[model samples]
Target: MRVLLTGGAGYIGSHTAVNLISDGNKVLLYDNLSNSDASVINGIAAITGVKPTLIKGDVLDEIGLVNAIEKFKPDAVIHFAGLKSVKESSLKPLEYYSTNVGGIVTLLRAMLKTGVNNVVFSSSATVYDSRQKMPVDENGIVGNAANPYGETKIICEKILADIWRRYSLNVTILRYFNPIGAHPSAMIGENPVYPNNLAPYITEVALGKREYLGVFGNDYPTVDGTGVRDYIHVCDLAEGHSLALKNMDGLKVYNLGTGKGSSVLEVLRAFCNVEERDIPYRIMPRREGDVAELVACCDKAKKELGFAPVYNLTDMARSCLAYARKNFSGKIK
Candidate 1:
């Protein structure tokens, strides 16, 4: 199969491209490089020995998407593009809406013009605002998220659902819980444009990029009193995308997560264990849109999409540590 991956140069998309190419599929990467690097293309080529065709353009541009579809004629499109920072989205709502929401409209329009019907989207776990639940499932009440970034995901899911219902498009929406870790090879992995997510922050602290890990909400209801979340490995998440593409019918949404919650203190402890160093920290107040705990029930994905997380916390920590140790030094950026 040939795939056109929007945001392909980004963390998950690039890793998925690696897996897809290894599986004897051709991949074309579509990215504007807003948050990812062009050097990643070289890294992918280094690892896989096959460079995915890349188009440098925004998803909002119709001409570029149409041209990409016509030239590539991909069997499916896996979209990983858009602004992802929860805090930033809260600050600049319109930019988030334009890039995240408007970008989808452009992709769909280009797909419609090019007669491409299959799509695999990168959705979010934020859709399920499960305050009382431990492991979030697809059937749970999808309460309105506390921020614009999550709301965009909710809105995109609805748009995809409506399109699938009306046009009979094959759409698979994968709701990602906190994705951490790197590739086992350490050749390619998560590279954030900004410091926002947990794993990266921990990585920075361990590398002395910052002074301490901010233990948000140390008074939560969890065993450790810190907020808990399901941190799935990036490879596992990449493999899940491959599983999603295997099916090309109707509408299916799956939760890609570890199914177990790890608190901020637990993450810090795990980093200490893995790196064999104490990470300095403080118990800061929880952010505005932050939650106390959220894991995932991935049984549906396991049963239907043949998806299951294979990497453990140790594996996750090791990979992330490897990447951070080599790439991020306190002196660099």
Candidate 2:
């Protein structure tokens, strides 16, 4: 299969590219490199022993997207391009909406023009309502997004569903939980310019680049009074994308997670144990749009797509530290 991945140089996209290439598939990466490094293409090539083609483009660029699709003639497209920071979304709502929401719109138009009907989207568990119970499923309440980032996902999902209904496009939306951990090779990992997620922040502190990890809101109704999330390994999440590509029938939504929740303090302890160093932390007040707990009920994905996450918190901690020690010594750029 020839697959086209938007934002293919980013963390999750690069991991998925390696998985696709290793599975005997061709991949063409389409990215603008706004928040990602071009060197990730080299890392993917080293891991897979195949250099996937990288098309320097943006998802919102209609002409560019159409040209890439026409040239590559992909069997399917895995859309991953977007602004993904929940906290930053609150500060830059326009940028989040224009890039996240508008990018999907432009991509759909280009796909329609190019007669491409298959797509696997990289959605988020944040689309689920915060008031819902633990372990959210595909049927869980949606549209009560806490931030603009989540709202864009909700909008994109709706648009994809409508497209499937109208044009019979094969759409697979994978709602990912908190994705942590680098590849076992430590070649390609999550390296953001401004660390937004908890795992990256923890890795930064472990590398002595940051003074202390900031425990956002140690007052949530949880085990350690901090936010709890289902942290899935990036490799496992990438495998889910491969599985989704195989099961793209009409329209499907799957939550990609480990089906387990871990508290902030618990994750910190896991990292400290793995690194064999005391990582200091400061508990700060809860920020807006933050949720207490967000877990996934992944029984649907397991039964349907054979999606099984095999990494534990310890593996996540160890791999993240390994990637940090290797990459944090110098600037990622």
Candidate 3:
């Protein structure tokens, strides 16, 4: 099948392109190289042996999207382009909403004109309200986002839902847990603008980018007084996209996680074990809107999409360390 991947040159999108091409599907990647570099396309081509059709364009541009859809005529589309930084969203909520919310509308309009219906969206677990219990399922009540970034995601979901109400748009919304780890080949991984995520921060400490790590809070009432989260490998997350396309029959929501939650200190210890060096750290006060534990109930994904994470915590730590050490200069790890 021919597939169009928006933001396909970004971190997870690049990895997903590799998997899709490996599975013998034709892919055309549409990206603006805003947060992602164009060289990522070369990296993916090197690994997959088949470079996807590259279109330099913005999803918010109706003319550009129409041209891409007309040229590629993809059987399905996986939308991954948007402003993803939570803190940035707080500062520039309008920009986040414009890019995320407006981009979806533009794509949907273009798709309607071109008659391309299948879609796979990269939603987040942040869509779950703060009142959610420990393990969040697809049935958990949706609420207003704690941050602007999450709010944009919720807005996009609503847009997609509204489109589906009138027509049969086969869509699958995959709410990802915390994704970490580099590809085993060490060619591609996450490249955060500010590096706020836990894995990148840990990697920075190991690489001596900073003198010591700072814990957000240690009195969260978790197992070790730190926050707990479900960390899934990036490669496995990419694999889930392929399965999602197979199961995109209706408006289905699946949690892409391991169904196991690990604490902050536990991840630090795991990294220490992988790097063979003790990590120095200092605990700090909790930040605003920080939750104690965020885990996913992934039984639906496992049963329906046949999704199962093969990499363990040690694997994640090792790959993350390798990427951090190799590309600590802030050049697309």
Candidate 4:
């Protein structure tokens, strides 16, 4: 199958590109290089021995998207391009809406023009309201997102649903948990530019870029008294996309995660064990909108898409450390 991946040069998209190409599929990467680098294409080639065709463009550009869709004529599109920062989105809500929501509008318009109906959207677990029960599933209520970033994701999911209902479009929505780790090759990984996620911040501390890791709220109701989250390896997340593409028809939703939770201290200890070095840290107040636990009930994905995470926490930590040590020079970019 021929696939076009928006944000294909980004962390998860790049990994997905390799997985798709390795499975005997043709992939064309379209990215704006906003939060990703073009050199990731080379890294993907290095890992998969096949370089995906790349078109430098944004999802908001209807003309560019139409041209690319008509030219590549992809069998499906895995949409992964958007601004994705919870705190930043609160400060810049308009920018988040304009880019994320507006981008989808333009992309859908172009896809309609080109008659490309299959779409796999990159949604988030953030769409699940904090007040919902633990182990969020596809059937969880999706309003009251904690931040604007999550709001945009909910809005996008609604937009996809509406399109599916009105146009009979094929849409698959994959709600991802905390994705960590890198490609085992150590060639490409999460971006260091303004690192916002826990894994990247832990990597920075491991590489001596940061003085200490902040343990947020050590009093939460969990095994270790810290917040618990489902951390899925990026490679596994990539594979889920491939499976979604195969089974995507009408509107379907799945949670891509390990179905297990790890606490903040547990994650820190895992990274330390992988690096074989002590990482300094101090307990800090829990940030706003943080829940005591957020794991996944991945039964739907497992039963329907045959999706299961292959990498454990140690694997996630080791691969992340390898990527950081190789790509970073103790500089916090």
In order, the Cα lDDT scores of the candidates are 0.88, 0.93, 0.87, 0.90
Indicate which candidate wins on lDDT. 2
Query: With candidate 3 superimposed using the best TM-score fit, by how many Å does residue 158's alpha carbon deviate from the native?
Result: 1.6
Decreasing TM-score order of the candidates: 2, 1, 4, 3
Candidate that would win on TM-score: 2
Worst 10 residues of 4 by lDDT: 324-333
Q: Compose the digit string of candidate 1's lDDT tens values, residues 142-228.
A: 867878998999999999999899888999999999888898888888887876788888888788777888876777788888888
Residue-by-residue lDDT tens digits, candidate 3, 42-148: 77877888867778899999999998999888999999998777666788889988999999999899999999989999998888885678698888888767788
Worst 10 residues of 1 by lDDT: 324-333
Candidate 4 C-alpha lDDT tens digits along 1-333: 999999898889999998999999999999999888888888888898987788999999999999999999999999999998876888889999999999889999999999998999999999988677788888888888888899999999999999999999999999999999999999889974567789988888878778899887999879989989999999999999999998977899999999899999999999989778789999999776677877899999999999978999999999998898888874554
Off by over 4 Å in 1: 329-333
Error of 1 at 258 (Å): 1.9
- Model 4, residue pairs in steric clash: none
Model 3 lDDT on a 0 to 1 scale: 0.87
- Candidate 2: misplaced stretches above 4 Å? 331-333
| Candidate 2 TM-score versus the reference | 0.98
